[model samples]
Target: MESFFEFRHVYKGFDGRAILHDVSFDVRAGETVCIMGRSGVGKSVTLKLIMGFLKPDSGQIIADGIDVPLLSEAELTQMHKKITMVFQSGALFDSLTVFDNVAFPLREREHENEAEVETVVTGLLSMLDLNDQRGDYPASLSTGMKRAVAIARALAARPKAILYDEPTTMVDPMMSHTIADLIQRVKRQYKLTSIVVTHDTSLARKLADRLIMLHEGGVRFFGTVEEMDASQDPVVREFLQQDELALP
Candidate 1:
């Protein structure tokens, strides 16, 4: 199997404060890896780096055999289509209706016809059980529905990989699990490469094929769920314990 994404000896910082130090990892096609950490431990930064929102201070990031740091403007445009991000806040436009929100990306590219757009966007919205809310604006939706709309919008581009940042945060208990299940089904059904960044181990356990934990500006552990459970390291144990308490 080919590696779809690789972070090699990456070091990054802002204003003399380092967020990542020599971090290295590779995500293969169709792989789902969870990057978990305590709050403010650079979990979101990791997602941003993969999305090319921030340049690393040093080292290399390779996605689909293209060097991210060396990519020209044209190359960056192609890379943008290969990956998409699901933000923590859902980031919907209060002004746009849900259907239009999902169709926004398509409209920007000017390639999809109304029928084509409706077919694809409606399918996505229906998958997340938001078909009836197509005309509803973000202001009318609940937190979970807003997230579902955001997720549908992200998938509108048919990206090869998705960077989900704190996908299940700040939702009801039932909705959280429902979203987790939706994520699992979506990945398998679409054969996607997913990198979910969150400290929520319960969600991680349900979705991750491999698990990685970051602490103190480095990857403290990278392994399977069984290995995580068996880990006797104080930090790993503590993190998992906290996760257990977080479950509904």
Candidate 2:
């Protein structure tokens, strides 16, 4: 598969401290790559750079054929149509019902056909097991349900690529499994290029075709799960050991 998202020696910083330095990785088309690391290792920053929410001080962030950092505001808007990010917070509009929230992107495209929007929204909601909550507001939903709704909203845009930021954090084990399963279902059904930033080892093992382990603003390991398991690097071993210890 061709590279859908490429980060080449990317650098970004806040204040005088660098959060990412010489970071690089490529997510292939139709492949799922998970970004993993301890807190403040620039895991989420990489996703923002891809979305042009934050600009790198130097280096290239190529999404599809466009160099993300160099795009004009108008150009970035167009690019955003083909790519979407599912934020960790779920970021739903409290005023919009589940149906409307999932339908928001389709409506923004000026479809004019309400029936089409209804069909798409209903299908996504049912697929994500949100059919029962379609009329509910964000305030009423649990954390996992909100994330599922957010994923539904992201898929509603029909993006070529999807970025997920910490999909299973703060949820109970059952809900965490549900979110992971929903993500895997989306991957198999949509065949989208996916980049997931998560610290959950089980989630990573389940969804990642490859894993990028970041540390101290750089990539410490980048390879398949088996390779990661076989890795001799002390950092990788220690991370795995610690994650295992934290599991319930």
Candidate 3:
């Protein structure tokens, strides 16, 4: 299988602190990989590094076989065009209505007419079960609704790879699984390669085709879901044992 994204012994730091250390992982095309870890273990940092929002101190981050570390300003913008992120807080613009908010990226990048944009955005919102809230403002929507809108907006660009940051955050049990199912559908239906940053074990178990567990900014485990469940390493077992709390 071809790896669409690869972390090649990546090392990154801030000020006088170190996070990732010789961190290496890969996301194969058409696979959904969920990153699982405890708080401050650099799970989210890994995603940011891959997205080129933060630079790695040493080593390479390759996406589609191109070393992301070498990408120029224009290349970075183009890369972003093919990759989208669903923020933890939903990241919807406060002033824009749901339709305009979802349409923003599409309008910025593509010369799609208003009708074409509306059709695509409406389809996405419908897929996410957010059709009714299309006319509402971000503030008027609930947290779950906002997240759904954020996802709808992310789809506007028709990204090849999606980075999900704590998608289960701010959602209750009733609506949490919808987000999970949507991610699954987005991967299978759209043939997307997704990198999900989440500490929610249940979500990981449900969404991950492969699971990578991080500890102290280093990878402690990497394998199929069954392998994680059957892990013998104490740290691995201990980490798996905390599946109940679901804390980040």
Best by TM-score: 2
Q: Please, what are the lDDT tens digits per residue for candidate 1 over residues 115-149?
A: 99889998998898888999998998889888888
Error of 2 at 122 (Å): 0.7
lDDT of 2 at 56: 97
lDDT measured at residue 74 in model 1 versus the true structure, 0 to 100: 82
Question: Which runs in model 3 stand beyond 4 Å of their true positions?
Answer: 245-248
For every candidate, C-alpha RMSD to the true structure in Å: 1.3, 0.7, 1.7
The most accurate candidate by lDDT is 2
What residue runs in model 1 are displaced by over 4 Å at the alpha carbon? Answer: none
Query: Tens digit of lDDT per residue, candidate 3, span 91-151?
Result: 8999999988998998996568888888998888888888887888999988878888888
lDDT digits (tens) for residues 1-248 of candidate 2: 68999999999999989999999889999999999999989988899999999999999999998899999999898888899999999999999999999999999997448999999999999999999999999999999999999999999999999999999999889999999999999999999999999999999999999999999989999999999999999999999999999977
Against the unseen true structure, what C-alpha lDDT does each candidate score?
0.88, 0.95, 0.86
Q: Poorest 10 consecutive residues of model 2 by lDDT?
A: 104-113
Quick one: RMSD of model 3? 1.7
